[model samples]
Target: MVAEDDEINRMLTHHQLLDTGLVLEFAENGKVAVEKARANRYQLIMMDIQMPEMDGIYATKAIRLLPGYAEIPIIAMTANVFSQDRQVCLDAGINDHLPKPVRTEYLYDTLLKWLEK
Candidate 1:
């Protein structure tokens, strides 16, 4: 599942990830992301950090408290490139961080790293 507020970024990620042959679902904001995550089982979640209504950090924390979600890999996708921002994602229980605009190769590699395991 991908939780992103921007349509263009979401579409781009969708296209980039299609080649992996994994079924994908999208959420337009962090609030929706948390709801979908709680109601469904996903192998991985691509979370946008700076979203409206909740933000990825809060969403991730909320999801972490849900049943069977503790082990799920939640990767943070954000424009904030600071070391402190990455640390915040880690503190929020995000498994990894991917900075935007996410490059196709890097995105693929990141997904592969989590999904393949």
Candidate 2:
């Protein structure tokens, strides 16, 4: 699943993932992301750190507390390249972190890393 507030980001990621033979769903904000994660199981979750209503960290924390989501890999995606922000994401239950503008190869690599492990 992809959770992003940016229309272009969500659309691009969804299309890229879809074309790669990976089924995907999108949420416009953290609120919607929580709902989607609770309702379905995803192979991976790509989270935008800065988002409306509930930010990615909070959403990830909440998702981790939800039943059956304990082991799902949640990777943080953000334009903020600061080390502090990246560390905070890891502290908030993100299994990994990816800086945006995500390259196609890197995105696929992140997916493969989690699934392969």
Candidate 3:
């Protein structure tokens, strides 16, 4: 699953993830991401931090409160690459952080790290 507000970024991510053989779902903002996440089962969630309606940190926290989602890996995807930003994600219950524009190798490796167990 991916939560991203930018259409171009979402499309790019979709193309990059096509080879992973995972069924991808998308949300335009954090609010929709939370709703979709609650309604479906996803192996991993790639979340954009700057989305409107709700930010990724808040969305991750909200998702963490949902039944069966506490252990799910929610990785923050954002242009914010500073250590402080990464710590913020971790504090918000995100399992990992990925800097954008997302590199295919990193994205693939991150997904494998969380989903291939």
Candidate 4:
């Protein structure tokens, strides 16, 4: 699952994951992401920090409270790469941080790190 406000970022990820046979589900805002999460189980989630209705941090925290989602990996995909920003993401219950524009290698690596287990 992916929670992102930007169409380009969502499409880039869609293209990148096409070959992996992963079915992509998109949420344009944090509210939608939480709604979708309520209905399904995802192997992993890619979340954008900035979004409408609710921000990624809040959405992540909300998702963390859902049953069976506590151990799922939720990765932050954001332009903010500062140490403090990353710490904040971690503090919000995000499993990992991927700085944008996300390189193909790093994205795949992060997916593997969480999904391969």
lDDT of each: 0.93, 0.89, 0.92, 0.95
TM-scores for the candidates: 0.97, 0.94, 0.97, 0.97
Candidate 1 error regions (>4 Å): none
**lDDT of candidate 1?**
0.93
What is the C-alpha lDDT profile of model 4 across 1-117, one tens digit per residue?
Answer: 999999999999898889998888999999999999999999899999999899999999999999999999999999999999999999999999999999999999999999987
Task: Show the colliding residue pairs in model 1.
Answer: none
Once superposed on the true structure, which residue ranges of model 4 sit more than 4 Å away at CA? none
Q: Local error of candidate 1 at 86, Å?
A: 0.2
- Give the candidates in order of lDDT, highest first: 4, 1, 3, 2
Better of 2 and 3 by TM-score: 3
Q: Which ranges of candidate 2 are over 4 A from the true structure?
A: none
RMSD of each: 0.7, 1.0, 0.7, 0.7
- 1 against 2, candidate with superior TM-score: 1
Clashing pairs in 4: none
lDDT of 3: 0.92
